[model samples]
Target chain A: GPKVLQIPSHQIIDMGQMVTLNCDPVSNHLYFYWYKQILGQQMEFLVNFYNGKVMEKSKLFKDQFSVERPDGSYFTLKIQPTALEDSAVYFCASSLGDKNTLYFGAGTRLSVL
Target chain B: GQQVKQSSPSLTVQEGGISILNCDYENDMFDYFAWYKKYPDNSPTLLISVRSNVDKREDGRLTVFLNKSGKHFSLHITASQPEDTAVYLCAAGARNNNAPRFGAGTKLSVKP
Candidate 1:
């Protein structure tokens, strides 16, 4: 079965530090997305990417956040000068197309203290 | 606006019993609805999906029923097992090319 893989199952960082989360989407997938789930809260969409550009982004996607699919190798989300409220489970998902079902990675847990 | 709401924050069922989870959405333009299961410390995995053109979709012990007019959907798990215990999230996509809006999720526990 096709699968999405995320690196660093867990990460802890200081409030002012920077962190980059990486995702390896399914080879044939054309659309990639990022979602965040705060403890005990619903999963919320962060952004969507396709054709090497951002398709849509939610208000939750802050200025400190950036996403890129450089060289078609890995899709990554980088947060600079992270804040305590940034702590959450970040999920990476991929789909064959915009409307197809998304397959998700195990998730990267980020904790900022 | 896109919003998906799930009912029954939590549920417990006997090993051989059935479990039902329901969801509702406010977006009338949504054309795709899906259910996902998530285990602790893991991302959600797609369980099943239904398009507005169809009312029911089933796979193995899991089934999804959609009511387009009411903007509601339900997932039914038959003969539940302990392994079926997990958080279930319902999501709806506005169009074929849009991102999905997910519900808070339902936590189900199948006891032995």
Candidate 2:
């Protein structure tokens, strides 16, 4: 089974600091997605990227958040100024296409103090 | 508004017993439903899925039942084990299938 790998399994940062989360999706996957899960809450969709452009984003994707896939490299999520509420486990997933099943990474646990 | 709702925040079952988790969707346009299992400190893993066109799908000890008429689905785990204890989430894809809406998740505990 294919797997998505997330870098820095755990990160602790001070509030107002910048943080970057990295994800390496399955080699052949075409659609990539980011999801956030707050403590004891459901997983919330953040954004989806394909063809080097954002396909869709949810309201939770705040203005400080940005995503990029530079030169076929890893997909990254950057928060300019992290907030306390931003502390959560961020998961990266990829699928062959809209109709294919998604594969998830182990997730990056971001803790903002 | 919540598009998907899972019943029972937590449940406990004895080993070798059956564990049933239920989920409901308010969006009639959602045609795809999936179940995922998540262990502490780990990302979710896809367990099973069902489309609106199907009534039931089974894989070994795991079974997924879909009731399109009621806009609901359920997952049954037979012969539960301690390893099966985890948070289970149910998600549904809208007609377009671009994003999936997830339920809050149900925590299952299988006692020895």
| Candidate 1 runs further than 4 Å off | none
Model 1: lDDT of residue B37: 92
The number of clashing residue pairs in each candidate reads 0, 0
lDDT digits (tens) for residues A1-113 of candidate 1: 79899999899999999999999999999999999989988889999999999988889999999999999999999999799999999999999988787999988999999
- In terms of TM-score, the best-performing candidate is 1
Task: Write the residue-wise lDDT of candidate 2 on B2-33 in tens digits.
Answer: 78998789999999999999999998888889
- Candidate 1: TM-score of chain A is 0.98
Ten-residue region with minimum lDDT total, candidate 1 chain B = B1-10
The numbered model that scores best in lDDT is 1
**Backbone clashes in model 2, listed as residue pairs:** none
TM-score of each: 0.92, 0.91
Off by over 4 Å in 2: none
lDDT of each: 0.92, 0.90
